[model samples]
Target: MQSVVEQFKQTYGRLNARSLGLLAELYTDDVLFQDPFRRLEGLGALTRYFAELYAHVETCSFTFEDEVVQSQQAVLLWTMSLRHPRLNGGQPVVVPGSTHVRFRHKIYFHRDYFDAGAMLYEHLPLIGMIVRFVKERV
Candidate 1:
């Protein structure tokens, strides 16, 4: 049997607006998912969140870079290649991020770490300039 982390990676790689059903195979009913943007509890809320996200993106894909697993917990490093019509002239933006997940059979806790500025704020027109300036100054 494949480990939960492997299943997660496979499922996540195929995820999109149409593949939102796959999330149920990877997470428990009451899973907790947290990222820089928001914290979601329950599979229903997570599905809605992904639906909204995928609806806006032209394309979004992940490249798994590395992982460290111990028992029921895993830390996965990944790069997300994203394209949105409103961001970066619809060109791909690569964002490096990581996910820490805990599972028994299906994941119940998943937290993602990534720079909000790099993913969203820095891609906006006016805000992007200000964010970039602030980042440069800091």
Candidate 2:
């Protein structure tokens, strides 16, 4: 029998430009997506949220850097690069990102974690300056 961790890898590893269905398949109907800017509930919400979330991105991709798994929990560490509207028109932002997945019903309950500065604002121009300034002061 496949371990829960293995199951998670199989479920999420197949993500691509057109993997929304696969993503929905891996998330429960009530899956909750928690992040710094948004907190959404249910697969419907998640799907809708992603549609907007992905709109700003012209092209995006992820590569798993590492994976730590145990029993029913798994952490998928990844490196992502995306085309940004503000950041050099698609500069690749290399940062450490992780997904904390809890498995149930062939899906995840929670899978979110990333540094906004490292992945987003920091890659932009004016926003990056402000973010860096705030970071240095506080």
Each prediction's number of clashing residue pairs: 0, 0
Write down the worst ten-residue block by lDDT for model 2. 11-20
Against the reference, the lDDT scores of all candidates come to 0.94, 0.72
Quote the positional error of residue 11 for candidate 2 in Å: 6.1
lDDT of 2: 0.72
Cα shift from native, residue 12, model 2 (Å): 5.3
Best candidate, lDDT = 1
lDDT of 2 by residue, 1-138 (tens): 766556556655554445667666567788777876688888988787776777666667667778887766778887777776777656666666888877755554675788878777877778988998999999
Q: Write the per-residue lDDT of candidate 1 for residues 1-138, one digit (tens) a residue.
A: 988988988998888889899999999999999999999999999999999999988788899999999989999999999999999888998999999999998999999999989999999999999999999999
